[model samples]
Target: MNPEKLAKLQSQVRTGGKGTPRRKVKKSVKPVVKEDPKIASTLKQLNVQPIPDVEAINMFKEDGKVIGFTAPRLSANIHANTFVVAGKAEEKSPEQALSDMLSRMGGGSLGPDSLSQLAKLTEGLQAGASGAGDVDDDIPDLVASEDVADSKTDLNAAD
Candidate 1:
């Protein structure tokens, strides 16, 4: 072998064919679900009955927010007063919610007294919204006014 050819061959490093062979891992097709037997057993033993014929359910939250559920599945355990409502929760404004509640109550018939009370309530709400004036405009000027306080006190007076 020629000296030049031998040096060239020695400088090159040997490697496995292509690269290291990778193992084909089998992935699970179904997800693994974990359940608690304690809660499940007691819930199954309860005599919870379904509340049928309910059109929808509305829940009122703070800040005049309303949560509504349409065509919900309502179940109640009358013995324990435990109720379960399952459905898709939605958002509705206070006006829409009030209208819906009225419509549900006896086909939306309002007497004279009910109309007057509603009108009064709406007027009260509107009066509070009477545009934004200057923040300190309504506050009276606070000055420490004590004109009649006795200023002369004897330091060495004996009782």
Candidate 2:
């Protein structure tokens, strides 16, 4: 080959090592979602009243676990018999829960009426918990052979 042509071909091969460098792909922009104005207006039309002066909401589970919501936003609609409680719920330890209840009671004294109500609640809860495990006479314990055969026949007929 001629020296000039060889030099020109070598230079072209070196320059065209990889055909093209890839461009960095841009991240897609997320579209902002706005609430529908019509729905907003409809919600506004509902005569939902705000309930004030509620500091905390506590839910006591059957297993002694308590879900406490401090600084709750409480609201109610009397006509609809609906209540809305919005808050950041936090599970507290048993000690914390006891103290919270004590604090709510100011004097740490439950009156006779309150005590009776508490006793009733406990009794009811205990009864309900025990009742769940008991076998009732109404529910059959064993499946009859004839009933099983009948169900199998029905299934075979469908096929």
Candidate 3:
């Protein structure tokens, strides 16, 4: 090879002129504020002591009972405000909004016991409306053995 060509090739390799671009150096960012001593002190005061691995704290419980401390604090004021706002937004009463929310939460319009009571009340209302001996003898027993067998057959066929 020519000495001049060899020298040119060596220079190119040494300088990385024909290779990948050099990465840019990043500027260091300074924090906006100094750490507050009061905040630091508060954090130190609130810091729970580390329990030994062998004697791990039961976060879900204390003593033999479920820990009440684990429950999130109920903010009645916030709840009331949210309820009011939601009611106004939907043109509904707060009570209506609360009922709707309960229903959406899989609680239905009434609680399980409340529903059972309501059902009994409705039955009593119907019986009272029809007077004494209002129980219709024509209504067939829904859970008879033949009905059960038919239902079982239907369910099995569906599967």
Candidate 4:
């Protein structure tokens, strides 16, 4: 290779200017603004705790639920009772959803035997779907069947 070409290549590699593309700078997320100080104080009085580490809370949330622990700030006149706000767990994967559902359904209380049943159900569903059968069967027929069934049951019971 020519000395000039080699030097240019070396410079390019060193400076990351030749083949490397420039990355777009990310816009910073702005903090949520509470318009009313009275509302903020009310919330503060309710003893809503600030999450010590938001990143840790995020990690805890990944396992299905987030548990926040915080002491009320001394300045605020908080109530004696502790208040908790629970939001739905956001599952990114089917496995996570299944795990979360099982946990919610008292899988821990049922012990290892419950896990076996869950595994069997998962396997059966997978096997059933692998065939020519409709995948929609996995989903509850909420639109028509449930309402029809409920109406019929209600009518029969009324009679």
Candidate 5:
């Protein structure tokens, strides 16, 4: 082989020899998502209404001295506000948004009413289990063996 050709082939074989450096591929960056100004303005305009029935429940007491304190949960009546936002955002309904919020608050979508209903259901079940409930006097007796035989004969006739 020619000396010049051999040197050229050797250079090509050794990648790090710098024969025309490989081009680096540039990565595409995802664009930042901006929040809708209208939604922001609407949310800002709507004032957060505090829950009226919420009261401070005593959490911890050391020798009558309250040491630990649990903050009262604050809520807003965002019913109307939620509808406007949901409509503008083209997302879920206001009810769905409210249910999602309730679910996030550790209560299944049922909220406060669920606790009462659950308690009633539990009480009813307990009463039924204790045998204090009504007897099955109204329940009819099972069909006799003759009736079973008649039913089998009817099936054979259909075939």
Candidate 6:
């Protein structure tokens, strides 16, 4: 081997065969501000608590029947009494609706456990759609009584 090539090989072996030594870059970090003890003490004395999280109800209905219903897994805020339903749970089971209503009513504080019992109580409370229990059996049919008079009389008068 030539003397120059031997010196190059020896240098490469000493430096682990790297082309150039890499430089280490230092990262600049921003300093964090220290909290004032007086402010911290005042805040601690206030004893402010975070507001409880409330979940909204998402109801899905098909053909006037509830096909899907979702409730938040977390316990709701019982003191807050306003409930917002996405849509009418028209076809929902009465008990399920009532239970959801109660849960929404104040985060289930009023009667979360009363749903099944209330449902049982309201089972027979539905009114017949056809008015089958009405005492007036001779209720007039509005369509029959409607004055659907022909326009010929008005047309003759106009002529």
lDDT of 1 at 119: 66
lDDT score for residue 139 of model 3: 69
What would the TM-scores of all predictions be? Answer: 0.42, 0.40, 0.16, 0.26, 0.21, 0.26
RMSD of each: 17.7, 18.4, 27.3, 16.1, 21.4, 17.4
Expressed as tens digits, the lDDT of each residue in 42-139 for candidate 1 is 66677678799889899866445579988998878988888777778989865566667666775888778766766665464344444323244676
What is the C-alpha lDDT profile of model 5 across 16-108, one tens digit per residue? 446654434435689997768985676567755545544232222212222221245444546654322121222333333333445556556
Clashing pairs in 4: none
Evaluated with TM-score, which candidate comes out highest?
A: 1
lDDT-best of 2 and 4 = 2
Per-residue lDDT, model 6, residue 158, is 90
Q: Point out where model 3 deviates above 4 Å.
A: 1-109, 132-159
Better of 4 and 5 by TM-score: 4
Where in model 2 is the C-alpha error above 4 Å?
A: 1-46, 93-95, 107-159
lDDT of 3 by residue, 24-142 (tens): 44346897865478855654555423222221111211111222211222222332342101111123332333334445555465777765755665565455555746456696766
Which has the better lDDT: candidate 3, or candidate 4? 4
lDDT per model vs. reference: 0.66, 0.69, 0.44, 0.52, 0.50, 0.49
Q: Over all chains combined, what TM-score does candidate 6 have?
A: 0.26
lDDT tens digits, residues 70-99, model 6?
Answer: 433222223454232232223565446656
Off by over 4 Å in 6: 1-65, 71-92, 111-125, 128-159
Worst 10 residues of 3 by lDDT: 82-91
- Shift in Å, residue 30, candidate 2: 21
Whole-structure CA lDDT of model 3: 0.44
Decreasing TM-score order of the candidates: 1, 2, 4, 6, 5, 3
lDDT of model 3 at position 63: 19
